[model samples]
Target: MKFLHIADLHIGKRVNEFNMIEDQKYILEQLISVIESEKPKGIIIAGDVYDKSQPSGEAVELFDDFLTKLVSLAEFVFIISGNHDSPERLSFGSRILKKSGLYIAGVFDGKMNKITLKDEYGPLHVYLLPFVKPAVVRAYYDEEIESYNDAVNVIISNEKISMDERNILVAHQFVTSGGVSPERSDSENISLGGLDNVDASLFRNFDYVALGHIHRPQKIGRDEIRYAGSPLKYSFSEARHHKSVTVLEIKEKGNVKIDLIPLLPLRDLREIKGPINELIKIGKEDYKGSTDYIHATITDEDEIYDALGKLRQVYPNIMILDFDNKRSRSNISFEELSSEKIESKSPLDLFEEFYEAQNNKKLSEEEIKIIERLLEKAGGIEI
Candidate 1:
């Protein structure tokens, strides 16, 4: 059976105060096109259906339309809620939806949600395990679940899993191998000090483990255990990530083929560094993607007037503007000033030193004249 594995939809997400509704809509349309071409038997959305617990009305409507299209194209559709979602809100009408081959497992009720599908190889079991914390699992079972690893281990142990049959587990959690953490992005809400990590060894009983909660697509321990990653790059740290949809074709037990189909975003996120004038010239001449989201770093030695305004003329979608000049890279400390030294120095001399230290350059003759006039008016010094 062939199935497409996707996760971290993060619908209704915003990047750098820019609404991503249109980009998300466009990407979902491309995903639907892929589904039509592949004709997969099922679609497994691991987790993170929404960016927030309380999503906007438009986000809900868009997801509703996407789900409707998905069910029509595939034989079955499985969805699980991630940490960002409200389980009760996501599971609404799930019982009724299951009748139409759309199964949602948002809330964990002390038992794993299992769905059996038949193919040429026989029966395949797919388990949906939503994002769970140690506290949530501890309340259901009397096991000593102190950490995420212990919680997941206890839950999987309780399930009557048969290694003889082809079994796939869909989950949303931080899985690690040999204490090595998966690649993370700024958009994810990670626990401090790695408290939420679950060992990948606990999933040895399953043929394929589809994971979520990590924004970068990668495998934890083996090829079958992997994270589908987010369909779009949510942070500048993930600017280089090539987002893709994970396609898995499972035959008999221990036999699975994995393929990654790339996804193209509406507006790619990029970073560029140069002087303001040079950057503007490059944007007009050689840069083809002026509308792409950008984080620009100005490396000019002297301060430029209206830097952001100048860049915006060429790159309207610029998200961040920074300076990497000597002033910005300076390590000057003001704590070295002593009371005696401060009292000995004239106010004008102190002001000049302070300005030079702050700007990494001496004040110009015109600026010095302006400051002297102001000081004279205030009767601080005679000029």
Candidate 2:
């Protein structure tokens, strides 16, 4: 059984205020070209189909087109909802869609959604496990669910799968190997504490575990257990990632081979740093050629007049502008300032400190009265 594994499409994503629907469309078309050439039996999209729970009309339309193309090419297309998706919204027409070989697991429903497919070897049971939380599992199961690992283990224990046949698990989760965490990017919304992380050992029984949620492509513990990563670089922190889709070929119980097919984007995310004049020289080398989304840091000691306007003349697609001079570098660390001194200060003293930090001046009497009125309205203080 051969299948294409992809995840974290984030269809409606906007990076640095630039809409990526066109870029997403381009990449989806490229994936369709791959599907046509490879002719895989199925495609598995682990999760995070849209950037937001409520996506735009354009995003819905774009995904509809992609699904329409995939439905025609592959026999099965499996999808599940991530933390970013609204389960009800994602599973609206899923019952009808599944009849046509498009299977979607949006809500957990206290059971694993299993679908068995046939190959030359035998039956391959594919289980779709949507992104889960402790609260969601506690509503149905009587077991103690304190963390993500507990929730997953309880669910798996309930679903008794026969180990004789080849089985695959499609999951969207923050999975960890031992105590090590997966490579993360600034764009991903990771939760605090280790409560959300599940151990990779819990999935050792499956023939292949297709994972999502982490934006970097990597193996959790073994070769069969992996994350396909996001199709595009969502943030400048991920500029080093070579985005790709994972293709898996499973022959039988213990036989599996994987390959990564690279994905080229319309505009690459990059960071460029140097003096303002030198940056302009490099930016102006080709007015029409260098269209990469850039985060440039100007290192000039003296303040230049209209720095952004001057840089815009050469680099039209500059997304972020920052100064690497003394002022920016001289910012105090958070640990150096403490809440120990805060307990003694009055509310007005705290306000004055904040005002001085922001504007380099204390609040005037009139401004203080305005703040007092706002605080009174909020029930924080009396006049």
* Whole-model alpha-carbon lDDT for candidate 1: 0.92
Those runs of model 2 whose alpha carbons end farther than 4 Å from true positions after fitting are 286-289, 331-383
lDDT of 1 by residue, 66-113 (tens): 999999999999999999999999999999999999999999998789
Span of 10 residues, lowest total lDDT, candidate 1: 328-337
Supply candidate 1's per-residue lDDT for 277: 86
- What TM-score would every model get versus the actual structure? 0.91, 0.86
Task: After superposing candidate 1 on the true structure, give the runs of residues whose Cα lies further than 4 Å from its correct spot.
Answer: 286-288, 333-354, 363-383
As for model 2, its CA RMSD to the true structure in angstroms is: 6.5
> What are the Cα lDDT values of the candidates?
0.92, 0.89
Which residue pairs come into collision in candidate 2? none
